[model samples]
Target: MSETILEELFIKRSQQKRKASPLNYKERWFVLTQDKLSYYDYDLNKAKRKSLRGFVELEKIKCVETVQPEPNSPPERSYAFQVIYDEGPLYVFAKNDATRGEWIKKLKEKVRFNKDLIQKYHPCFWADGMWQCCQQQVKEAVGCKVLEHKNGVGFSSKNSSRRRPSRKPLPPTPEEEKPGCRPLPPQPPEEPSHSVGMTVIAEYGYTPVTPQDLELRKDEEYTILEMTDANWWKARDNTGREGYIPSNYVVNAGNGLERFDWYCKNMNRSQAENLLRTENKDGGFLVRDSSKAGKYTVSVFTKGGGESSGNSRHYNICTTQQGQFYLAEKHYFNSIPDLINYHQHNAAGMVSRLKYMVSNRAQPPSTAGLGYGIWEIDPLHLKTIRELGNGQFGVVKYGTWMGQHDVAIKMIKEGSMSEDDFIEEAKIMMKLRHENLVQLYGVCTKQRPIYIVTEFLCNGCLLTYLREGQTQHPTTIQLLEMCKDVTEGMAYLESQQYIHRDLAARNCLVDANGTVKVTDFGLSRYVLDDEYTSSAGSKFPIRWSPPEVLLFCRFSSKSDVWAYGVLMWEVYTMGSLPYQRLNNTEIADQVPRGLRLYRPQLANERIYSIMNRCWHDKPDERPTFQELVVIVQDLLYELQ
Candidate 1:
C-alpha cells in the first residue's frame, strides 16, 4: 500500500522490542538508522566488551559530562544502511535501507513477487512457528525493530474451531471454507449463549424504565414478572406512610417464574410531556391558526365493526388566518368490545368480559353464533388518509384501514431497519395494549418494503395542540387531570415490563373530548426480569434525555422519571421547552452532572415536590408513576 504504512510497520517493530519483558538477557540485537537511508545492526553480545567498557563504566554517556572516551566508548557495530532523509525519528521499524550495498543490489536485480514470502511476512494469529521465527527473520532482515506483529500462527484456539459439523447440512458454498474470511458455523453444542429471546415491554410509572438492565443471565434462574412496567400507589414513607413505587422494580419473589401484567385503575393525570421544544430543531407551532384547526378529522377502525354511520364531530384549537374557531372531530372512539367478546365466546365457550377478549379464541363461525357487524366502511372502495408527519425512518401517512376507518401508516425507510429489528419491535407490540398506550396494528410486509400500521388519532399530537394556546387556562384541576392521564398510561406500560426509550409530548395525542392516548412504541424495550445493567442514551433525541442516558447510556424507569420531570416543566409552561436557557450540548452535559431545569411557573408547592422527586439523581429515588397518579388525582379532586 502506501509507504507511510510500511514505515509504520518498522516503527511498530522497534516499539515491540522496547516493550518486551525481562530486560536483561543475551541474544539482544537492534537495528539503528542514521541520516542517508543507511542502517546499522548491533548485536550487543557480539560487540567487543572492551570497546564499550569505558563508556559503560562511566555511565555518563547519556549526559553532557563526557570528555569523549575513545576505544571503549564507541562500540563496534555492523552497518545496515544510512537514512536518505532526516524527515522523521531514526527509530526502529523504519524503511529498509536503500543504500547501494551488496544485499540492496541483489534485491533490486531479482524482484520476483513472492506470495509465499508475503504470507510468511504477514501477521497472522495461527501461522506456523507461532510467528516467532517470522518475527525474528523480519526483525533481522529489515534491521528495524518494529513493534507490531500479527502473531496468530500456531494458536490453539484457532485450530479448535475448524472441527467437522455433526448435525445440520452445509450451506453448499465452497468459498465458505476459506480460513481468513469464513463465518463461524452454527454449533448447538457450543453453549446457550448463541440463543436469543424475543419479548415485548410496556411503559408506566413515574420513573422511566430502561432496556439495558434486562439481559437474561444463563447462570442465574430468572423469574419473568407478569407486569412489565407496573406501578404501586402508596404514600411516601418519610413520615412513616406508604408511598407509591413503580411496579417495574417489583421483581418476582419466586425464581424462574413468569409474572403477569398487573391491573389498576384511576391512573393519575399529572404526567410528563415527551416533547422537548428546545431540543427538536425542526420544531414549530403547526396549530398557530385557530380558525383553520377543524379541516382534518381522520379515524381508523377494522372493517365490519359496528358504530360507524355518524360524521363524528371534531374540534381543533389551532390558530388560523381568519381567527375563526372551527371544531372538527379530533378522535373517534369505536366499540370493538362486542367483536372481541364474540371471538372469545366462540373460542372459550364462555360469555366473558368483552373488553379483555382477543380474536384468536373465535372458532369458525357457526350458524347459531353471534356475528360481528360492519360499522361504517364501504369495502368496495379504498381511500387515503391525511399525512401526519415525517422523520428519518419514513413518512407517517394516515390511511384507511379495511374501509371507513383510518390508521396511521409509518412507512419505514429502506435500510433504516433490519428484519431482526422489525421482529423485535413486533414481539414487544403483541402483548402491550392500554388506553394511554399507542396501539400497534398489523404490519404490511406483503410488499418488498414493509410499512407499520398503527391507530391514528383524529386530533394531531399534543405538541401541535399545546402550541395553539390553552383551550382553557389549565386550572389546578385541569393540570392535575392531565398529569393523571399521563401517569395512567405510563403505569400501564411499565406494568407490562416495557421501557419507553423515548417519552415526549409529541408522542401523546388528545381527542376533541380531551381524552389522551399515548402513541409511538417504536423505541420500546423489554426489561427481562433479571439482575443486569441496562445502558441508556438518547439514541433518538438528546435534549429531553436524562443525565445517565447521555453519559453511560444506561437507564431504568427511574431515568425515564427524570425525563418526565422535564416534561412536567413543559406541561406547566403551557408547553415551554425544557432547559430553554441552555443549548443542546449544555443540557446533555448538565443531565449526567445531576443538573435539571427548574421552572418558576410550575413552582406550585405540590407540583414542584413531585417534579423534584421525578428528576432525582439516583433513579431509585424517583417516584413511581402510580404514586404520581395518586398524588395528582388527590390534588385535582381537592381543587375541584
Candidate 2:
C-alpha cells in the first residue's frame, strides 16, 4: 500500500478497536488510497501534528452506500455514508452529496472486485435496536428491499439471498375437469402487435416458459414483438429470439413501477378503499391488486352533497384481447400507469378523475421474519400491541415482532417440547409458503413460557365469517370459493406429506378478501408427531374425527379428508356445530355406529353428494385433497 503523495480522503488509517465512540459530527482527516482507507485526527493549531485514529482495508469492505438521515439531523452530517466490512458498518459524515458521492464512487471502485457482495441493504439508519426502514428488530436483518447492481452480484450472504441459476417458469395453466368443466378463458389476440416495438429491461431474471417464450435476464434489454396479454407479452431478445415474456417481470430501462408513486403492489382492495376514503379528496385515487389474481383495480373516492367521507368507487382496470388496458371502453393505453396518467386529466367514463395518491406515506407490509436466518427473536424486540383473544391456544395477543411486523403471539402455559427440536422442525415450517396457509414465522423459546408467532389475518376466524359478516349471505360461488381456498391449502400440505390433523373452520382463518388459509399447520408435531395434547386434553379432535381417528387414533391424510367433510358441513350450514342437536357423549357413541349429519340447506344435491364422499366409512374410499380441489373448482366455475 503506497502512502506517499495520496489525497487525505483516499486513505482511512487505524484498525485499533475502541469503546465509547465520539459523536458522528466529529471531523477526522481520511487518507484515501487504491487499496487502503485510513483516517486520523489532526491538530487544529499544527497541520502536520496528526494522530492515527482508525482505518478500514478497502479489500474487506462489503458495501459502500448512503443512508437515510435520522429525524432533525444536522445538514452536514445528513450526507452520511456507511462503509460495511467484516467488522461491521463504519459511519462517516461528509460535507455534502458531492463529497459523499465522490468518496462512495471511489470506495466502490476499490471494493468492486471483493467477494460476497450483499444484494439487499437497509436504506434507513439502524437505531434503537431496530432498522428505521422496515422496522425489522434484528440489527443484521436482510434488506427489506432489493438492491440492484449493474454487475449481477447482488445476493446477500448475511441476508441469505443466493444467486439462482436460470430455470424455466411454466406459464400458469389452471386445471379443468372433463366434459362438463368450463373451457379455459380465451388467450389474448396474437395478431397485430398492440404497441409499436419498444424496449424493456428485465428487473428479475426469468427462464422461458415455452419455446415461443423469450428468456428474461435481469437488466437485459429486449424489443417488444407484440403485446399478447397484460401478464404475458411477446418480445425479442438482443439475439433476435422472439417469444413471450411476463410483462410485470420486465421494465422500461428506467426500472418500472417498483418505485413508481400511486402503485401499491401489495395493497388489496379494502386497504386502498380505506386510504382513499380517509383522504376524502374529491378525486383521491390509487391502484391496487384486484380480487381476481394478476389484475389491478383503480379505487377513486368522491364526496357528494355534504358527505363527510364520501363514497369510494372501484373500477377493474380491464384488458382487451389486444392487451390494451382501459378504464373507459373506448380509451385505452399500453400500460396501467399510462391509463392512470391519462385518467388523471380526463374522467372519460369514470365517476371521478384520478388525483391524490394516498400511498405517498403508505408503508409496505413487513416480511414474515425479522430477517433471513433470524428465528430466535430477542425478547426486547417483541411488544404487545393488544390482546387479540384467549381461547383454545391460551391468551393469543396481537403483538409486533421486533416492534414492526404485526404478529399473533400464542402464549402457551405448559409444554415440555425442547427448543432445539422445535427449531429444527420450524426450519421446514418457515419455508412452507402458500397463499392459503397462515404462515408460521417463528417461535419464541428464549424464555420459560413459549410464544408462537403467526401471520395476522385481518378478518378473524373463518367460523365468524361463516356465521356473520361477509360470508353471512354468501352466494353459491362465494361459498364455493371459500371452500376452494381451504382445499387448495390442504392439498398443498398433503403434497408436502404433512397433515393438518385438526382440520376445521375454527382452525382456519379468513383474510379481508374471504380467502381462507389453514393455520397451525404441522405445528402440533413438536409436542408429539402422532399425539397432540392441547391445554384442555388430547388434541384428537373428536367431532371432526372419522371412525378410524375416534376409534384407533390413526391420523393420516385420509383422516384429515374425513375432517374436511365435517368442515364442509360446517361451511354449508354456516358454521353450525356438527350433530346440531346431539350432545358429544351421545354423538360419539352413535357416530361410530354409522350415524352421520344431514346435508345443509345451503348445499344442493351435487354439493351434498361431494360432502358425503368425504365422509366415507373406509379411509381409502375418501376423496384425496387434490381430487377435491378439482371437484370444488369445477362446481364453483359452473356456479359462476
Candidate 3:
C-alpha cells in the first residue's frame, strides 16, 4: 500500500451475497475510499479489523461497468455491476439507478487514474468464484491465454479486433426506430361486444388530446363505439366526436331521469320545473342556471325557513359560486341542476344537497356535520377567563360561553388572516363531530377580534400530559391505551378521507378521562383520494414527517400513519423529541438513506414492530390507521 492518505468519500450500509450461493447474503457496511473500496460488518462502537469481509484494490482494476441480471439472481440485485481486475471481478449491487451510477463513476475514475498499474487483465468469466461473461470451471485459473498481454502492455488494434469479434449487430436506422415502427404483438381473440346509448351524467369536459381526437362534454348523448376497458367506455358523442369517457360518468339512456336521482345536467329549465312540481306538489322549489359554463341547479325552497329556522332552507347541487342564476326575484341558485338535485333528495339547508345526502349515508354519526352546523356566538356572552396558549395565527383563551359552558376560544390576531379564510376553516371544523374530536361551539365573526370557541380539554395537550406523566411512570397498558385512543380517532379521520397533515402528540389533546383527542386542524385537508400535494414552499414539521412528505411535499393518510408511529414513540418514551440528535437538514439527508430512530426505551418488541411497519419507505406498504388501531387494541388487551 502507498503512503497516500485516501479520503473516505461515501459510505452506505447494505447486504452482500456470496458468489457461490445466492441465498447466502450478509449485512455489510460498504466504505468507498479514494484509492480502494471495501466491506465490513457494521460496528456500533469501533471498526474491527477482523470483521473485514473483502476489498478490491482500485489500482489493479481494468474496467467497471453495470451488468445485466442473472437468470436466478434476486430482483433486488438487478442493478448490480462488476469491478473487473487482473485477479478477478468484485460483484456489488446498488439499491437503485442513482446509487449504481455513483459507484460506477467513482470506480471508473479510480481505474483510469491507475491504468498503468494494471498487469494481465482477466477475460470476463463466470468461473471458480463469480459469474461473468466467459464461463470457466477452474478454481485457480488465471487470465485466459487467448487475450494475454505483457506487463502494462496494450494490445495492438489489429490483434484486438481479431481476438474480440463484434457480436452485437449495428444500431437501428432512423426509419426503423420511428413511432409504431415495430410490429404489434398478437392480440387475444376479441370478446362479443354490446352497443348501447349512454347519457353523460357527469361532465366529461374536454381534456386536451392528440390533434386528431375531439373533446367530449356533459349531457351529450353518445353511442357506445366499444368497451375499451372496465373503467372506460369508447363512445361517439352526438357531434360525432369519438373518444373514451369514464364508465361511471355515463348511464344507460333507458335508465330515465329517475336513475340520476339528483341534478340532471341534460334536463332543460321546463323539464326541471315540471319534475320538482311533481315531486313536491305545493312545496316551492328554485331552479336557476349553474355557475359552470353550461350547467344548471334545482334547490328546494322552504317558505320563511332562511335564517329564522337556524337553517338556510335552500339546498343547491353545485357548491361553487359562479354568479347567481335567478328563479324568482327573491330565490336564486348557483346552478339549475343543483336546484333539481336538492328537490330529488328533498334536502334542505345552505349546504349542497348531494354532499348532505352522502354524509347522511356514508359518514359516521359524529361527522354528519358535512357543512350544516354553524352559528353566530354573541361576544357579550363569552367571558375571557385566561390565556391558554399562543398559536401560529392567534391566542387561545380559556373562556366561558353563555355563562356556564367552558370553552377554548381561539381569538385570531387582527390581520392575521382574512375573515373569509377564518370562516371557511371554522365551517370545516363545524362539520366534524366525534367523541375523540374537539367540539366547536360557535364563532363570533361579527366582532373585531374574531373568536372560535371549542370544547376545552381538561388535561391540555397530549405532549404535555405525556411529559408530566413521565415522573409518575405510566405502565405499558396505560401507554398502549393512550396510543389506542389516538389511533381510533385517526382511524375515524381516515374513514372520512381526511388527512391530518400536522398529526403529532403536540396537536393532540388529553381529556379529564385520559382519552386522547386529535385536534389542531391547521394543516388538515379533505381529499377525495388518499394523497394531497402541497404547493411549493409550504412549511412542514420535519421531525414527524415521512420521507415522501419531507421530500416531495406529498401528504396522505399513510404519511399521517407515519407521524402516528412517531407519536406512539413519544408516548413510550414519555414525550421525548423524535430524532432529537439530528437537526432538520440532517434528518432530510439521513432518512432517505434508510436511517430511522431506534425503539424507545420502554417500547416492547411488538410495539416497535408496528412502528417499523408504519415507517415503510413506500407509502402503500404502511399499515392503515384502522389496522394500527386493531393492533394497538390487541396489545392493550394483552398488557391488561
Model 3 Cα lDDT, one tens digit per residue, 1-640: 4343332222222222344444344445666665567777666466543366677666556566656666676667667666765444566667777878877776665555442232223444353454354342332222222223222234432233211112232122111112342222111112233455534443334342233333545555667766644334667766777766545445565533323434343222333333444443234444333322233455442323343322122322322222444433444565544445434454344333333221011111122211122357778878999988887547998988657567788887675555665465565456555556776666889977887778788789988888887327666666776777788678767765566778888888876546578886533332212232221112667778888877777777778888898888988999898888877788888887788879988987777877887887877556667656545644543343
List the lowest-lDDT window of 10 residues for candidate 2.
Answer: 180-189
lDDT of each: 0.38, 0.67, 0.56
Per-residue accuracy of model 1 over 503-558 as CA lDDT, tens digit each: 67776877543546676643433222232222222243576676566776665555
Two-way TM-score contest, 1 vs 2, winner: 2
Off by over 4 Å in 2: 1-291, 296-318, 355-363, 380-395, 398-406, 415-420, 434-436, 456-460, 464-497, 509-517, 529-539, 546-574, 584-640
Index of the highest-lDDT prediction: 2
Better of 1 and 3 by TM-score: 3
Q: How close is candidate 3 to the true structure, as a TM-score?
A: 0.41
Deviation in angstroms for 279 in model 3?
59
Local accuracy of candidate 2 as per-residue lDDT tens digits, 125-182: 7665567887755444445444555123443323432222133221222221223322
* Candidate 1 ranges with C-alpha deviation above 4 Å: 1-382, 522-540, 600-603
Model 1's number of clashes is 120
